[model samples]
Target: MRCLYLWVIIALFLMTTCPSAHADEAVATQSFWAGLSTKAKFQGEVVSNLVGGLASGSVGNALFIGGFSWDSERAGEWHGGKVVINFLAVDTGNPEAYVGDIQGVSNLTTVDSLMRLYRLYYRQRWGQVTERLGLLNANDYFDNAGVACDLLNASFGIVPVLSQNLQGMPTYPFSSLGSMVALGGGDTTLQAGVFGADAVHPWQQPFSQGVLMML
Candidate 1:
């Protein structure tokens, strides 16, 4: 699979420059304003075959993902901001997971493993906007009438918002809203945000079919 997308671009360039080299020792401590912040990311993608030809066909199909993000700022007084954890480490190849046999199921193997957590939240910023509930893996909110687009920030561009299987068509909506967009500049800095709508149950109904749009 193209060497897992070149090791996810060298693990996103070492998690965006290794945290600015410790950001000056975390700004000289002092309870660091309630410390505890960690982030990690790695991505990969590859798909080539032009059309398909070669016995079992398959000239391209690769993916490598690694993720980790944790926050815990001001952890009291009904909690404040920060307290998230994200995870992703997939390898599409269809060993039985990826996507093969249409729907037959047979432990395929070759594109990606399929495991995402788009965002696990607990943020707070009520003033200029910054509200995160919890349990997020797909559909990072979406409400056209109000004007929202927070599919886990990436400067508002990660290209994810399509779900409709069972004949509906769309597809590619699971795996936590098909997340994949973290390639900015350097010094590492990638924040994420998505809203809610599933009302809560029914397996979160694909994150309420999109409506909140990054609160």
Candidate 2:
């Protein structure tokens, strides 16, 4: 994870240190944007013994996300094309291990404590229709409600009844190789996708485990 962080920092440094060009030239050719964010949480078990055993404890952890986006129109390559690269880094410890909550106390909490590529996708749009290929997160397009945007519980972010039962839903913490297409514009639009069933390391096996399609 440290190595991954170093790489991201170095890349950002290089981008920022590049020779300065006219603002119009930068916008007419290509544009790059980078961002880094971290969320830390501490959860303690006050009362338990009903679900994950009679043990009570507390755990603290953090989630780090850093990435960059490149736009074709902004980069002056083409129109309606963009590329995104994102990475996820989880600190040691799982909050659910202490809270023993099925819904999860923190939405950012995950079992894995490592750094990995989270999203790497390219999108192209033609009028009202758009196509995206490569790694993806299903929740970003489906079952997403503005009302629950700030919720911390895992179930609130994505309905557990569906996300939990699905073998590879491709929500958070885990992503899969997939392709998505959408038609229409304005307030009404239609989207459909086919994603790999393997939650972890889907790129290695592709859709060997099967596929999950969403509409």
lDDT for each of the candidates?
Answer: 0.40, 0.74
lDDT of 1 by residue, 98-130 (tens): 222333222112233565554555666544445
Model 2's number of clashes is 3
Candidate 2 has which clashing residue pairs, if any? 29-75, 29-76, 30-75
Model 1: how far residue 9 lies from native, Å: 57
Over 4 Å off in model 2, which ranges?
Answer: 1-57
Backbone Cα, N, C clashes tallied per candidate: 25, 3
User: For model 2, how does the per-residue alpha-carbon lDDT over 57-103 read when each residue is reduced to its tens digit?
Assistant: 55655667777777777654668988888888777456566565677
Q: Any idea what lDDT model 2 has?
A: 0.74
The C-alpha RMSD in Å for every predicted model, in order, reads 21.0, 13.1
